[model samples]
Target: MSEFFQQPPRAGNRFHTDPSLRLLTQWHLPDAIYEQAEPQLERMGALADEVMGALAEQAETNEPEHTPYDAWGRRIDRVRIDDSWRELMRIGQREGLVAIPHERAYGAHSRVVQAGLVHLYDPASAVADCPLVMTDGAVTLLQEHDPGLAEHYNPRLTAREGAWTAGQWMTEKEGGSDVSGTSTVASQDADGRWRLYGTKWFTSAVTADMALALARAETSAGEDQGLSLFLLELRNADDTWNGLEIRRLKDKLGTRALPTAEIDLVGAAAVPVGSLGGGVRKLAGLLNVARFWAAIGGPAGVGQLLALARDYAGKREAFGSLLRDNPIHRRWLARISADYEAMLALNFETAAQLGQSENGGPKELARLLAPLNKLACARQAAQTGSELLESFGGAGYVEDTGIPRLFRNLHVHCIWEGTTSVLAHDVVRALGAPENAEAFADDICRRLKNLTTAGTARVKQKIESELDVLMPLVNDPREEEARRIGWGMARIYQGVLLAEFAEWKKSAFDDDAGFATAELFCRRGLVDEPFPETDADTAGRMAFGS
Candidate 1:
């Protein structure tokens, strides 16, 4: 008898392996634009397999180390990460992951190309994508609000040779999401320079070159009108700490490779990005982009695991046949894949809308889609990630197989820019505004106006029904029903987007399962098929403390 040894799952180049991403890119980009972008996309895809996969494996074995002192025990406050992390950062810079959209050589399709790059990078960058996300947001905010700072910083932010990673410093000990209650204050020094004087409770990009922070700056009108956004350089020209002291690194649940720190900002030099008392309003630009990252992250992470599962199914034999040949396993994978397909479609739609806004297109539609895309996509990714990971059976739970990392890394997206509940409220508020509500209605009509496929008609009908259910909550804009409203809106849009993809697949590629997949996704995903009344009642009675 021959000894049995399991064959490890293999993943090839991301751009070539992912037909869904390829098709979407082809659909969004013209032939001329695609010709320009395809080589870069393919290069990043190869990096995903050759470089990032190894880095991810290395990070699992070795975490970032914080040494508060040198050998002589002086306060150096040094955080040392593996060389692999640095390599990942270089790839992000070299490949123009953050710079592509900002560069805009491809016109409106630039963001679509950038999104593909980001989705490919996120799964294996060992959470290096965290700093890049903040960097992109900082670049966007600085370019829009502060010209001098933008001129000084953006060149570094977008540079390929010496790119800068910017930390987002918003959460403090006093408040997590509610920045209005912030205690950190920014005051002018004797030199007429603004300085931040407070402790940041949590800062994820502790190893960043610079940081974007929110600081309390009061005016005579009210003593505390609101917060203002500030940009902080972590180091001086001599490379010493510039009025900043790292207290300690966070002992976190996951993302061990990403250095998160608690630090004291005592007289840290800062410059306001906008008006002194306008950060609460001005912060929308940064938050909007960050939420888009969170939304993309959900699907990107799931796609990573799904890619592995795709390989494993063809090789792993069970009940005298490969798992791919087994009806039950194959059907289960198809369902999870369908949901992943739905999320990619929706997030890419968000990307396209954001691109339009960037290139002097409709601003209101982008604003409305921001919160809706983040909440809905994050929630769906969480569910789909769990299901896909479980498809590997025992190997899914094994850390050595690199499968369990999906869940550990996935929880952050659900809470990163905003928690699920927080984003739901944002969606409701966006809809509450009259102009935003009007733009949203027009967006729905615009997205669904051209339907060429029969499946799209069914998808359209299903979406109309969901709109009937969810549109009322948006019109009334209640807090309690915000979750349903936000999620329902996302589901409807995803259904329509997937239907459109199905039509393209059939007409362009002569595929039939594309239609079935979209139909099944809508049927299963659009509404919460209510559980049995007795089962729910009993479950509720026995739940938790009860």
Candidate 2:
């Protein structure tokens, strides 16, 4: 059996053969894009695996006694592995991850979603709220403390510049995802310094070195209008919490590894991010960047979950046969495989588009696609993982099996940047905008018409057939109808796009063995499934002529 599986040749192992890792490393960069970034990506992956592996091993033994904030710490610690947290800052500095650094100073954010999954699972507990609020607070503080540190990407800085390992930014409280509702106050001191005073909830505030907090600058001739981002260094010169307080932690279902803290910001020393009144817009840039990373991290947990379930099926025997041999199990594998591939393709494209911001590219388009990618991929990851678990029968429910952990972790991604409903509204809003609605619609049409692969073409035709039924309703511009149309079009367009890429990959370009695994994404994402409701709607509409 050992000889058969052969341990999927590890990156540096004697005979490691992990197809997925190889796929990620190889196909992540297209030929045109791979030439420059390939080496960096590979190095990053290797470093990530090394740090992550060490942490995983430590987690097994160091399982600290369950504390309320363990989830938050664990998640942050997971991201800090090797140099991921630092690397992210470096990437942001180089070109502003999604136009936050170069264009907006406060957009220097981290991948809390990835860390959140692991942290939420930590023994310590808390109730769930927006993690982005916590991230905002952390990012602001770091940039303020070291103005030049935001752009530090070189490995040498890891040793030279001492900074907080990981922390969260807390901006949203009752304001929902709307940052304008923020009421935290920052008053200038008599000694010519600034201090923060307010109550903030859903703060992923940890025992880190700094925090990025948003508050209204204090003045006597008060206007509730002035909002600013402040970087408050939480740790003292001796590394102690001086004024910031973590009031209580929330208890939650998924992402227990990261604690959701209710923080009391009383006389917390702070500095502003950009201009005082410009904080909200600055945070928007940060949120946009956060949204992009959330999209990327969404699939990470899901992929891990699928791999776990696959391992379970391969090992567990039932009804006088191995689970892997069952046709039902095979079908489940195929289905989840398709979901993962679709998500990867969508996110990769989104990231690539975001990277183009440096060349004066269309950022609004990236912004439009960002929410869709975040919401769609995160939702899909959770749903897909749950479905995959059902295939494992009773075994998956057991904690020792580890399927539950992955399922819970993936669940957090859906609610992170924006909720599903929030995302749906955003997509509709984008569609209604005069600037891109027609172009977006036209883009959908072209994708549908092109029909890149046999597998995708069929799916595209099926979605179109459904859209035709909803056409009359869509033309009216009602929010509900528009949302339905938006979702359907995005999915269909994605299918077409994936199929086209699949066809391209199958052409003469790729020959490397590493691409072989990643190629699975191209083929699997293009597979067509039936959509009878769409077809039925179109038929009914055509017959009624109303």
RMSD of each: 3.0, 8.9
Extract clashing residue pairs from model 1: none
TM-score, one value per model:
0.94, 0.70
Cα TM-score of candidate 2 = 0.70
For candidate 2, the lDDT comes to: 0.52
| lDDT string, candidate 1, 1-546, tens digits | 999999988767868877887788777778899899898888888889887898877875788888888899788888888888888888898889788888888898888888888888888888788888888888998888888999999999988878988988989888888776678888876666888889898899888999988888744233654578888889999988888989998887778788889999988988888667788776688888899888889888888888888998998999999999999998898888888888889888888989889999988878977888888888878888888878888888888887787677877888898898988888888887888877776777777787766767877887778777666666788876677777777887888888888888888878867777787888865655433557555777867536
* Best-performing candidate as measured by lDDT: 1
Worst 10 residues of 1 by lDDT: 217-226
Q: Against the true structure, whose TM-score is highest?
A: 1
TM-score for candidate 1: 0.94
